[model samples]
Structure formats: structure tokens, C-alpha cells
Target: MKSSKPIAGRYLGYREADRAAPYARFFNPELAPLAPHVCAALDRGGVPDILLPDIDQATTNLFGGEAVLEDGFVLTSDGGMRVSVRSAMPSVTPAMVDWWFGWHGDAASKYKLWHPQAHVHVGWRETPPAGASGRVLYVGQTSIVDEYIGSDLIRGAIRFVPPATLGFTDKSLDDDQQATIICAQIGLGDAPIDIGYLAHHVRAVPGGSEMRSRFWMGGRHVAGRNLIGGMAAVVAKRVLSVTESDARALLVHCAQEMPHLASFLPELFGEFKDAE
Candidate 1:
């Protein structure tokens, strides 16, 4: 097997701002295949897990487990075998999510992918615009429009976000510098996107008190109640019946569980939200 050092470097490159292109970035160079093996082990009726130390050693954590390598071991428990890796687990992207569930066996097909569909931020611009007018632009996923046209019977009716409303820049960066790079790896970057705080709508006043950006994932960002927050948003849609505060709570929890799920949470959740 390839050494973990090279793999870690690859990860860093993928997470960087400049190389963080959707579908173009690396998802799981060495660990993706393990998903199927782990799933197969779990089918035997025990908790199964995989632990990756850096990019090299992979530890198999199981309910009634065994040692897989010198640097790795499996932990077995009643709830399930806790798979702990000395190294950090890569964040799940849309493509990775699909692969994990798709190959996990027959039981995984019903599982729903989860992540924040849309994120919105609101705050005041204490400083003036860097250039001309403050920009407001939207990034959209092609699938969204395709699905819209497919179900709505609308042709040439699709709307596009003007460049003025969105900030479009291409730059390469390291994982420490940008998290969006990770999002692009697994294909979630293509979501219907809209960024920047709006000044005035049809009837809304031009207020500068709050500068915000909202995120919409399309379906649920979470799978079910069991997996709340990002996961729920990925798989299910937000319910009007639920209060915004509660919905946010779910998001907070999701961020806590999967720090790499999205890149902007550091700004959204404050400094602590940024995890290695």
C-alpha cells in the first residue's frame, strides 16, 4: 500500500482553495475501498469500524474485534463496535456519501444523504465595500434546474444568477486555509447556491444592519432524527412546523459531528467551529 505521507499531502492539496474543484478533487484515495469491507463485516451482526492513522495504517474497530495492523486495533461494544482511527476520518462528500451507502449492501440503499442544503449568514458590514458596489451573486447546481424543468414542465424558463450578486473567484489553497475545497471533492459544490447579503427586495427596505448568506441543500440535509443537523438537511427538507431555533440546533449538532461536512461553519459557528 502507498504510504500515508503522500496521501496526507494529497488531502491537503484537495482541501486547498485553488484545487477544491467539485468532482475534480480527490475524495478517498486509500480509504474509499474500505467502506465496502466494513459494510460486509457489519452484515455479520456486529459493530464494524475503520480507523485511519494519518494516511497509512487503517485500524479496524469492531464489537468483537481483532488487531488489523501494528498501529491499528478494533474496539467492540454492545451498542456497536466503535471504529476509532488514530488519524482523522475524511469528511463525506456527496459522491463519497453515495459510494458509502451504495456499496454498504442492500440495507444502505434506503439511507439518505445529509448535509446543509442551503446556508444563510446575516451581519452588518462594519467596513465599506472593498471595490465598487457590494456584490450579490448566486451559484446554482445544474441538477436543480434539470429537476425543476423535468417536474415543472418549464423550458427556457430557468433563471440565472447575475455576476453582480455572487463572488466568483478561483484560487488554490491548503486545507487550513479553505474548507470549501473538501466540499467540492464529493460533488456537493454543485448545489443551487446563493451568496452575499441582499440590500433591497421588491418591498424590503435597504438595510445594512445585517450582512448574511443563506444555504439551501434541496432535500433534507440530515438522514432522519437519528442523524440530525447536516445529515438531516442532506436527506430531508426542513419542516415549516419546526421553529428556526430548533432547526439551527440540529445544524449545530451536525457541525459538531462532522466538522468537515462544510467549510463555512467556522464563520457561521464562530472560531471553535473550525476543527482540524
Candidate 2:
């Protein structure tokens, strides 16, 4: 196995950012050229109204004080890519987030997919019912080529575990402050490829609340890690370009279909609502 140092340096560049406040910036300079394409795709997906009335109040009600929102994308050390728009959902509790993460109900429809009809299979092992840990299969799509037939869905297991699993234990934290760790093991037909870890941190502020997510990816190939890394980067660009649109579509779908999630919306600018 190759050392993950180089990959980590490329993907986890956010660690060098100003951590004093929520920051939004791209990590991989090589991927900078794709930003316009990503934004354009997102525009076509019809962005939702993320800004809603009482959004700050709602975050305060659920998380603690004022809310913080940030948007950006990262190229994983192993070549995978993810674009995220995160904000504090004050009206939604950590338990709620945990539930949503575990729940597979209508998930296939809720999120944008290259293949809407693709079947999704989920299995749980050594996990609680409310806070889940399990494996999910995209059914027909496995390899990179298969992604064109539908989507390059990772054949992996997703687990929602305690922060301690990631070595995050702070005694001075408040009771209302909470954190959730989600990890994924990516592979194909028993052969591991990559791993992803995401940390969801929620804390109470003086008058409201804040939630932040940190995501990282690591290559898992036992050999030819560099070759796999190159291929992954190429695939990441293609996948991320379309996925950005998918994300925007997802937010819009949630706002329209799941009214309960409205509390997290930022006031929608005309451009987002009227996207072509």
C-alpha cells in the first residue's frame, strides 16, 4: 500500500485554510478550470431557495444560536470528488440528521441521479435502528463504464457513528453540542478502492447554532495507487460536473416535496429560482 500523504495533501487542503470562520474555497488548483462547468450545470438544475424566513431562528431553536452556511467542493485524495453546500438547520436536531442519514425511504427519488430507475439495495449490520450503519448497493452500476449506463454509484457501506470513532472527544463541549461521524468504504466486487469520511459538527452559539462538515477521501488500493489515483481524478471531474446539477436539483426537490425541510432554506435569490 502506498502512503496517503500526497493524496491527503491534495484533498485535505482545507486544513490550511483560516479555521477561525467558516470558509468556502476550492482545494485542488488543477480542478479549478471545471468550476464554470460545475456552476453552469448547477444552474440548469434549478437551485432551491436556501434562504427562508426565520431560518436563523429555526437553527437557533434546534442547534443554539445564529446559523453559518458555506458552499464548495473538494477532490478526494484518491480521485473522487464531492461538492457540498452546508448550513445550520436550527429547526432540525442532530437526532433528525441522524435519522435522515439512515433512512432509505424514497432516497432514490429524493436525490438527483443519472439513472432514476436504478435499484438501490441497503443492508444493516451491528447497528442501532435510529442511528444506522450499513452497506448500500446501487444494484446495476459498479464500475466506471457502468456509470455511463446510469451513475458511478460506489459499492460501499455507509455508517453513522459517534464522534469518538474518529477520536473527537472534548470534555468542555455543551450537552446541546453534538457531532456525527459518517464513513464509507468504496469498492467493487470485494476489491476495495477508496474510503471517505465526513464529520458533521453541531454546536450552540450565544443566540443561535452552527453546523460544519469536513470531508476527506483516502485511496485503498494495495498496489498501483498512483495509476488508480490518476484514473480517479479523471472520473471525478466528469462525475462532479453532473453531480453539481444533481445537488441543485435535490435541494429544489426537497423544498417542493418535503415541506418540513423549509426551515433550512436561505432566502432564494431570483437567479437560483429561475435557473434554466
Candidate 3:
């Protein structure tokens, strides 16, 4: 929101936006009014309850494709936080979700299209290997991005992984047909240490698809690259743990980005899925 792109600093100003891309219509260059549902979800509050970092059981709830804590943030008892946001995406599919994730990381322009106001820049480490397509293009790749969770600018690494890696044992998950869940390990910048986990579960619905996004930030998932880093993380954990404000910010970010993405994802995918 400050400058449309990051202007300076370590993780900022890496890439500039391509204003003349064919995907321009796929997203707005500005923010629109929050949808009514989004407003309501932000109004109501969520508290951390039974699903306290127990992702195996929580993944079961997600597979059902029903609304469970449909929206809002939960401050976990373990000094971590969880954010839940469900977006109803009309005419969007699980395959499109996969394609979008894989395709967007290729350029900062495409990444900005997901959330113009919040997203600043993005770069891919190793993506779309030879002979890899669809979900394969991104499932094993890592994307480094500079974006805003709320008012704070964050530079983080998102490493996509298979559902089995996160304990989503549903038999139908092997393919991205009926449902597609994008799971990732979240880290601070390019560091080898992982600090969080996230899953965006896009399940088939009657009209289109619904994405149930979940984030588990901090808690036992936080780790370091080595023994020295581990000690640093321990000290940092006691001093600067995730809080309610962090959860609320993440909830708002997810709530905004997904719907904006679904708005034009179908058309975007249809046009560029094969070529791009």
C-alpha cells in the first residue's frame, strides 16, 4: 500500500510489477470494498479450543468440506496462533488453485494479482522442473515472497509439500481432481529454520469450490537450522511469541486474497493454463 512495490531493504525491491501483462484483467490494481461475508467474519471472533495444534484431527475436519470455525482467528494456549478463513469461490476448481499457485510464483506481477495491496514482490527458488506440470510444478518448489500480513511487511519462504507430508491421509487426495489441498512449510526469509505451517484446502462444492485455509503459526513447529539457531529461536520465542493481533492480521489477509483470486481465476486459468 505504501509504494505498490517494495522500495528498499534486504527483501524488498527484488522485482518490479509487469503492468502490461495479459493477466491484468485477472485482478484489480486497487482494493475493493470487503465483501459482506468477509466483513461479518471479521466481526465475529474465534477462540482456540479443542483443535489446538493437533493437525491430524483438524485435517479430518477439513476433508469433510464443511465449515468448521469457518472464519476468524484463534489464539492458541501454547503461545502460538491459528487462523481460519473459508472463501466461497464460484466457478473455481481445485485444479485452478493448483495452477494459480504454480503459475503466480513465476513473476511478481502474477503474485500481485492475488492481492495487489498486500503483495509486494515474489521470487521462486526451484520451480516447474522439466516434465512437471499442474500441481507438480509447485508442490515440490519453494517460493520466497515479501508481502503484508496486516500492517507489517514480512519476507517469508513458502515451501509447498504433498498432503501426505502433513498427514492428510484421505485416499482421494493423491490426485487434484475432487479436492486439492496446498500445504506448505513457512519460514523466515531464506532461513533453513521453519516457523509455521499452512494449508489451503480447496474442495469441490455444488456450484464451484470452497477453500478452507488454515494456518498454525509458532508453537512446536518453530525450529532452527542448527543447535546455535535452535538456542536463538528459544530465546526469541520467550520474548516475541505470536499474539492475538498476529492471528487477526493473518485472518484478514487470507480472507481478502482468496476471494480476490477466485474472482478471475477461472478465466485466467482457462487462458494460460496450457501455455503459461
- Judging by TM-score against the true structure, name the best candidate: 3
Q: 148-239 in candidate 2: lDDT tens per residue?
A: 11233333434344445555555423343354323232333223234444445555434333444434333222121257655664454344
Relative to the unseen true structure, what is the C-alpha lDDT of residue 217 in candidate 2, on a scale of 0 to 100? 36
Better of 2 and 3 by lDDT: 3
Q: Write the per-residue lDDT of candidate 1 for residues 62-150, one digit (tens) a residue.
A: 11156542122222221111122111233322222222211211111111111212111111112112221222211221111111111
**True lDDT of residue 51, candidate 3:** 46
Error of 1 at 166 (Å): 2.9
lDDT against the true structure, each candidate: 0.21, 0.33, 0.75
Which structure among the candidates has the greatest lDDT? Answer: 3
Q: Model 1, residue 73: what's the lDDT?
A: 20
Residues 97-154 of candidate 3 have per-residue lDDT tens digits of 9888878897777888888788877888766563444333787788998898887887
TM-score of each: 0.19, 0.38, 0.87
Q: Which of the two candidates, 1 or 2, achieves a greater lDDT against the reference?
A: 2
Ten-residue stretch with the least lDDT total in model 3: 9-18
TM-score of 1: 0.19
How much lDDT does candidate 3 score?
Answer: 0.75
Name the TM-score of candidate 2. 0.38
Name the 10 consecutive residues with the lowest summed lDDT in model 1: 195-204
